[model samples]
Target: MKDDSTEISARRRYFRYAVFSLTALLVMSLGMAIVPRQPPAPAETPFSERARAAALADALALRAAGQELAGAAAGDGGPGTDTALDRTVTLLTIQARALVLPGDTPTASAGTGPGHRTAQASSAGVPASPGNSATPGPASLSELATDLAASGATRLTDALEADGGMARLLAGAGAAQLLAAGEIAALAGVPAAELPGWQEPAGPSAQPSPARGCTSAGPSGGADGERVDPGTGAGLGAALTATLDAEHQAVYGYQAALTRLDPTAATQASSLLAEHLDLADEAETYAALQCTAIPPTPPGYVLDPAFLGAPAAGLARLESATLTAFGDVVALSAAPARGWAVSALVAAARRTANWGVDPGPVPGLTLDESQLPALPDRPENAALTASPAAT
Candidate 1:
């Protein structure tokens, strides 16, 4: 009887222990249910990265707007309008393709032109026109002009925050947009002064240090003096010197061309010549700030006999060549030097146009249009061709 009683006590102890464990587990689960768990916070995007994405998005939108305008022009406007819109579209396409992220593969499709995503109707304070719709309607020329100017202004603002290579591209793109804006405005009979003007942004007071392995002293000396090698790693100093060299050539070209030009053309040439002289002085000041050796200007530059024969065409070619030098300055220097370079680029491009030559899509960038990345496939843009403005 005592053995049976002890066995019952053991069973009772085991039952109590099981009950205690179950109660504790229930209490803990209830406690857990009452407390809220927090989720992990998202990582912050860097400003430079954000700027790049914004630029890409803007490029896409501008391209779409250009396409819309082209279509409208085709239906109602004259051939001149069609031509201008086509060129503008081409420029926007190149910019959009260039702005694509390094590793993000664009959608592949046969004969795909500049891809159009369903982006915001307006970006960077630019108002959306009727053309931004999914089923876009015809837009007025005046509205298109306003959009281009605002878009260009936004690009310049973004350029201030982008990396070196991107900054250069953005500056060029911005200048192109502004140029197109003026052209479109002219077509619409809008006053050029009414459009947005290029304003230099505030930036680092001091220039960034030269690239690693670069020295103030250049690789080789010319007959004039120790010429700064404008090669890679030569930094802003070399770039400025190179630009000064180009300016020197431009100055000489204008002087030579002035003699051959008609009286009216000569008057304009003389004004431009004075401007070139001022530009040369400005380039020298920047070079001196960098401690780069400035070479003496040659007494004369070699001019093509054909160039001498047709001074106007030659002047256009000369102005176009200066664009590369200015672009290098845009890439290598920070503001306000970069701002200066951008202005120079715009002026040169306009001058090229003034001389009756089209600056092609991109003025500063020498691109092989054939090798540029094909536009990515977007379901929304299935109906768009690779060149919406083509013939």
Candidate 2:
């Protein structure tokens, strides 16, 4: 009888232990269910990095195309091959400097900028190979134009706006790319009229006085105003005035286009008109801060007859002209002013593309008209070339 009692006691102890273990497990699981876990954070891309990557991609593509062009030119002795190659090299060199390499200053001049990614290659005074590695695959001239018009200028614009030593370098580099892209587009057979500013007028070097017989005169002072000290002004006063005048022309052109455009096209025209007006206002405000005279808006601007019925083409031409003026501003302005001009130029190129205009090989710079085939003689077209006035 005593042995039977002992066995029962042991069995009871084992059953209790098993129940306690089960309860503990259940409590633990419930606690775990009640608590939420935090997620891992996402990685952020640095602004400088993003800008450098975009610029590197284009530099590679441009260098590859340039090599092919050089080869073809060498084999066939083409007339413009050397010119194209030279421009390509100059552009690539500037882009190489804009790559945001370690130890590079953001404000370095493109012409004398330093970079480490291709420091060795650059030291040799050659177009640094793309990525400081083997050349990328071939890119056609048309492909280059498309790439540049699509993203190159805008990417550089971003870099130009970023804070630091690099932004200044990007401004110069970006401007050069805009000029080269337009020139290349023209060479690729894009219509001359399609890229109004792509081809340089006969006497681009001559800066006419805005005061002389100023038909399209504006508010404060004219382009004829005396030159200020380059050291102190960085040419901001003159550049701001020029840009404001261009903005006025843009506003007027877009306004005229809005009246004739179809509903869909009219909306785009209206938006651009407002944008130009805002830009004009901003320019004026900046001029005031600098104590410079703001040019007044002209009474009327000249527009092509074609624009009266079909606004798209006319608006596009005006945008191209504005783009040219901005490029010139970039070339002449300093630091912040140049950065602003770069952004404006990028926007203008985008607008021109929207209006059925293909940004030529060089979107912003004027090319020699001789390179293009002559257009059919139109006396009316003379008005288009007669003056760089309002229209």
Candidate 3:
């Protein structure tokens, strides 16, 4: 079973303070609710009426939120949110202490000029505003924390709002921030090890290459569904060899089609074929780091240029040939090794189609996304060139 390692890891800091750190976040999140809001300035000219309404609303919201939090497990707080021990106590402490301050609102929201000074100095039935929105009055800070721990936040939105109104409480609330960071850190773990970010850590740039032991391409070489033989070498080298073979065949088929197509289409196919060649060369060089005996064969598969007739007919045959060759290579690969070759073939076939040459005239097999490059999260700029037929 997949453990909450990810979640727990995210709340590492909170976990550091107390084992029940996550519990705190969960409990507080459960109780979040919207307290009654202050009345609009137009509706209540007397600030006292608006303030009373706000307090009343806040109380109801707090009560409702508290009930919710009570039933939820700490699991509900999410990774790193360690709402229970860290956020809950911190927020509550702020609010509890804040309730003692005298102000128009939390953090000292007060009218400036002569009025505020008079209100502060005299306190003769006048409301003293907050010094800053970021610094809620002591009473507001305490109440706000109390409200959040009780029931005010449900989604991330609520949490943000609660934070906004509880400045004094948030002053020393670095713990909540840690919880969020912890969750993010946990998620970043696996991928970080496998695929380094732009700033990669430099270690020993050298590694011993695996020996190439196998002799022939295994019997599995057939269609898109074929697997590799256990007879071959492991990992990057085996994958590179397989891909290189496929690239060679694809290049050959593309050249065969070029002789039969219009000048424009032929030129395009030639360019794509060159790209495959370049990719193959790169794969071979990189692959040298893994295995020794990568069989580089001289160009053999091709039709006589004189036999090339109708552009359409030539393309149709070439596509069919390339597709079948792809299947054959795949059949020769082992299960783990098939993924790389499959990807190369699929990408080549798609680019071939961009030349407007459909091998379907000869029953070409369908290649799938599983055999191509990783799909973008959102393919906003997806474009397929007009096929030869379409043109």
Lowest lDDT 10-residue stretch of candidate 3:
113-122
User: Model 2 has how many clashing residue pairs?
Assistant: 22
Residue pairs clashing, model 1: 113-386
lDDT of the candidates, in the order given:
0.68, 0.54, 0.35
User: What TM-score would each prediction reach against the true structure?
Assistant: 0.73, 0.44, 0.28
For model 1, residues 1-391, the per-residue Cα lDDT tens digits are: 9999999999999999999999999999999999988878989766556555555555665676678778756857787788888887787788777766656433323422332222233333332211223443434677567666666665666665566666667777777888888888888899998875656644345543323233444323212343222446557777888889888988999999888899999999999999899889878766765656778788888888899889999999988888888878877776577777877887888888889987766677777777777666444332221111111
lDDT of 1 at 385: 18
Q: TM-score of model 3 relative to the true fold? A: 0.28
- What RMSD, rounded to one decimal, does every model reach? 8.6, 19.4, 30.1
Superposed Cα deviation of residue 386, candidate 2 (Å) = 44
Candidate 2 structure, TM-score to reference: 0.44
Displacement of the residue 190 alpha carbon in candidate 2, Å: 25
Give the distance in Å from residue 83's predicted Cα in candidate 3 to where it truly belongs.
Answer: 57
Lowest lDDT block of 10, candidate 1: 382-391
- Model 1 vs. true fold: TM: 0.73
Candidate 2 minimal-lDDT segment of 10 residues = 381-390
